[model samples]
Target chain A: MPEKVEITPESAVRAVLRDILGLDAEQVAGFDADTELFGALPELDSMAVAGLLTELEDRLDIMIEDDEVDGELFETFGNLVAFAETKAEE
Target chain B: MMLRLEEHNIGAILPDLPGTNESMQPQHAMDLDKWASALLSFSEQAENPTHVASFRGGSLVDHKIELPHWRLSPVKGRSLLRTMMRTRIAADKESGLSTSMSDLMETAHRDVLNLAGNLLNPEMIKQLDSAQPFEFSDTRTVRLESEAKEADAIVNGGPFWLRAEPSDDMDLVTAISNDLIDWVNG
Candidate 1:
């Protein structure tokens, strides 16, 4: 049987920021692991958050419950990546 | 006595609004007001509304609804409706209201197209509406074509192109397409 492939949260976050937010390569490249996201990035507004979560669910094939969303998960790039990773593993 | 409805109240009112599937016209403001009032009353009676009804704004204004988070101008009808729709979906999410698959698909379609118009060139956006085959991305090719369907069909059986790659993450692609369309349309 072929080994199951897994999507890393880092790649997912980068892809979502680049693809969904339309952030250019340079802008996305600037997002370090610790870079703050939710409030820090103007592109990641409320609507953008919804779109991101939905996209993440679709790409990672993970279900994110409404209650699972909170500020800490989006506090920084690392935080979001960790959250996605956890969800993907589950 | 004036009544005030907050953003959450507006959220509750949306699902109950008549003709939600149709685009709202400017002339329907009065009808919207009536629907809002009735919805508010029903919500109050249910005692489970997200927002409290209050007397404020003025005597004629029975429901002083406010969506502070939206920051929408009262003058713009289209903007108001859009904001309301967005807010309603968000609120429904919080309230655990199950959205139908068709409704979700429609919302996704609109959002994707809007984003596509934003990120892509006008030529690209226009091309998407045509029957000619073209590349949408490095991985996806699209072409529009017509199809015959039953009158009451829920799915839009054609006139829209299907992405060529079956194994690709279509949702992510659709999300990316939204930015392009949004740029073009805006």
Candidate 2:
């Protein structure tokens, strides 16, 4: 039997962004703590955001209630990753 | 995908299921059973041995094919429905109309619903919400390495289906082609 690979919340967040926004590895890797997301990235529109949240929930195996999602959570790369990390712990 | 399959002398026929793509049927009038029957009928017309390869929501209906199935990251119908619903809600919010999941579901139950871009009826929504891939002995399930779902094989690839625009990933395509060849010939 193969060992299960552990997925970190930060990595999960990165993957969701890549998949949902169609960004390449280099582009996502370029994002730093302060890199803005929602408004800064034009591709991260409302439709994409819905898909992004679903992908994040699927990858992290965490349920995100509708109320938990706000514009602030997607304000920056750090905030999104931090939210994922918090969700993973709970 | 067709080119790769052709290299292995495997002919492929991508049919338009009822109410989808080029099909003349109305989307709002189609249900799971109708789609499944369409697949079954299509398979019957093939002269050679056929293998079903389904992706995402297609898995729910591919079970009716009665052939050895190869599924790539097959998803439950409810998950697909939820994504569409979420997309609809997000679109509505963008237009200054606040909508909830319950609101959408209620409308779907009562009348035809325009979700994301597709028009679906109540019965279609009801069936999709509870549909699951059938468990069969001849099935081989494949999932992306990022996914934690139980699968017969795991492959490395990004979820291109979720991308905002149509994009090509040859490495991912080649990997899938190779795996599918092995599955078919093995």
Which candidate's TM-score is highest?
Answer: 2
The CAPRI category of model 2 is: medium
Model 2: per-residue Cα lDDT over B1-186, one tens digit each: 879999998888888888988878888899887899988988998776568898888899887777899989887787778788889989889889989888889899999999888899999899999998897887988878767567787888887899888888898898888889898888
* Tens digits of per-residue lDDT for model 1, B13-55: 3333432345362222333345456555655566444432211
List TM-scores of chain B, every candidate.
0.21, 0.97
Alpha-carbon runs more than 4 Å astray in model 2: A1-4, A30-32
**Overall local distance difference test of candidate 2:** 0.85
- Assess the local accuracy of residue B150 in candidate 1 as a C-alpha lDDT between 0 and 100: 15
> lDDT tens string, model 1, A7-53?
46677677667655656657887888789887777766656666567
Instruction: Give each prediction's DockQ, rounded to 2 decimals.
Output: 0.03, 0.51
